[model samples]
Target: MTGYDQILAEVCATGRRLTRAELESRRLLGERAAETGVGLRVLVRQHLAATRTIWPTLGSVDADRVLAAVEQSIDAFAEGHERAQKLAVRREEAARREFIDDLLYGRSDLGRLAERAVRFGLLLTRAHAVAVCQGGTPLDDTDPATRQVESALVARFSERRVLLATKGGLLICIAPADQEEILAHFAKLAHAATDGGRVAVGRAHPGPGGIVHSYEEALHTLDLAERLALDGPVLHAVDLLVYPVLTRDRQAMADLVRNTLGPLESARGGPQPLIDTLTVYFDSGCVAAESARRLKLSVRALTYRLERVHTLTGVNPADPTHRFTLQTAVIGARLLGWPQTEL
Candidate 1:
């Protein structure tokens, strides 16, 4: 048996358990733990001294072996102690998560918890923003990818305090104090993961109490953009509000063609039919044959309309320059949401 095994067996035979208190007392008697605290080498020397006192008649090799066994025991004990400490920390972390869930969802006293977390320096007490990203896949089932993405984001924004969680297909992030920086970082990461899958981003909002508010706004913006078939990979909240204006403005520009070329519409028997023909004409890449087919008019009838349009609007229907002018007027009218007075 090893020297440590013999010593441990003897202690067990004594029928008195060597509690931590007893071990500390023995350490004090030899100043072992104290000297070791100063330096690990000092602790090794103290162990050697203790070994000689414990076994005086042993030969040199036996003494060295005994000392080595004791050192190994010390290392094992230290490792066990560290492992125990980590397990305790993990348990405390689990409890903290439970508490946070209760407080954030309003099941517990949030005010009290907030004050305590701030006082204990566990969390910042100020306002924060919540950003939710949908990575086009379930994060729970894809642990490795989720971890890789989370690690990248953490490394990229090490200075910013962020809390991340995964629910369903969403990667939820709580950013403290610097929402814009976090959002931009997330956007870049999402773009880099283009080959992985499509990612949809939501808006960011001020927090403390406004996290949900902002998260909802971002989700709504994403939904609107998607419904309208906006280009993606990165969808901004403001774009939803802007795209409609551009679309409507394009139609208004078409209206201006009919209004400016009024004499042409009158000859065609009505402005509306002529305007519809012109819209199809411009929208179909200025192809006279396509516009004539769409309007169910002969090519000759379409040509007459074009000539009248040129005369009234002082623009050639066939000329690229005048085509641009007609297109611009339609866009301006739509964007301005023009009434008769504005037109």
Candidate 2:
């Protein structure tokens, strides 16, 4: 091992605290590795495993004599060691972040990735799933519940083969397989911690490529939920796939609604009854009697509503082409939050 490695081993064996002699040696390393005294503050805190922490100060006191060359050398050694330690930590952190970014982006070499995964308790060959959670985690790995998720970076969830990190303002996590009940429970704890953080989970898939697929799907679910103004603490991609596909073209959707259903909105007061009538009519499989029964409207009134739809939209529900188009438009309307959207 190198001299620096030996020094670290010695430090670790020294227990919870350090002596004045040890501090003196590290101060020099701190000075050498740190660009300035200001950045050295961060270096010192990291050396102490505490953020923004400063060295203890003492009140003014009289000293008998000045320090000798040996004393000065000892002080420089301590300072330099501290600085070197911080620099080493920064390098390791950057490398780890790069690996995670590569894995998430599907750019990592599989053989190397698998080796790295093994060191981190991840078996990449197993089934995997991804989740994109919005917001920060309330609890750190010190809690036993999050121990399984805890990595050197303090990323975690619960008992599952999982990796976690925050990137682009989102908490991206990968877990072994998709366990709906377990994930749902995790969702509850997470939301409770943040008082309402949104989460999007993807279906589980096998192998490394599957992990990438899950992450993309989860991200897609989040985008879809945002575009559609959907609300829920946790949303699954399976539940949201249809809406995302249907609303891919908002302009086209708005235009279709305007040409097909806009007329009904201007009729008799507002669009509520017309929307309700159409929904019920379709729900009843275009059977006037069944729709009337469900709507609690007489068959004559239901027919009149249908007739009004035909007169305004120039599309009769009886025509298969017209019925299919109108039904698609209504579904689009709901997904795009139409009429209410002022489109």
lDDT of each: 0.55, 0.66
| lDDT of prediction 1 | 0.55
My TM-score estimates for the predictions, one after another, are: 0.48, 0.56
Model 1 is weakest, by summed lDDT over 10 consecutive residues, at 334-343
| Model 1 lDDT tens row, 1-343 | 1244455434434433455644444344334333334444554465557665666444333444554446555554444444455566677667656554543454556576666455323353555555556655566424665566678887887766666555546665566544567766765665455343444444444333445554554565555544433456666655455544545555455466446544453454544455555667886688888888978889898988777767766778689867876655543433443323333
lDDT per residue, candidate 2, 59-91, as tens digits? 121121111222333445556756676787787
Clashing pairs for predicted structure model 1, backbone only: 203-218, 249-331, 249-334, 249-335, 252-330, 252-334, 253-329, 253-330, 253-331, 254-330
The runs of at least 3 residues in candidate 1 whose Cα sits more than 4 Å from the true structure, single-residue gaps closed, are 1-68, 75-79, 92-96, 99-107, 116-125, 140-142, 177-179, 190-204, 219-230, 237-343
Worst 10 residues of 2 by lDDT: 50-59
Steric overlap count per candidate: 10, 19
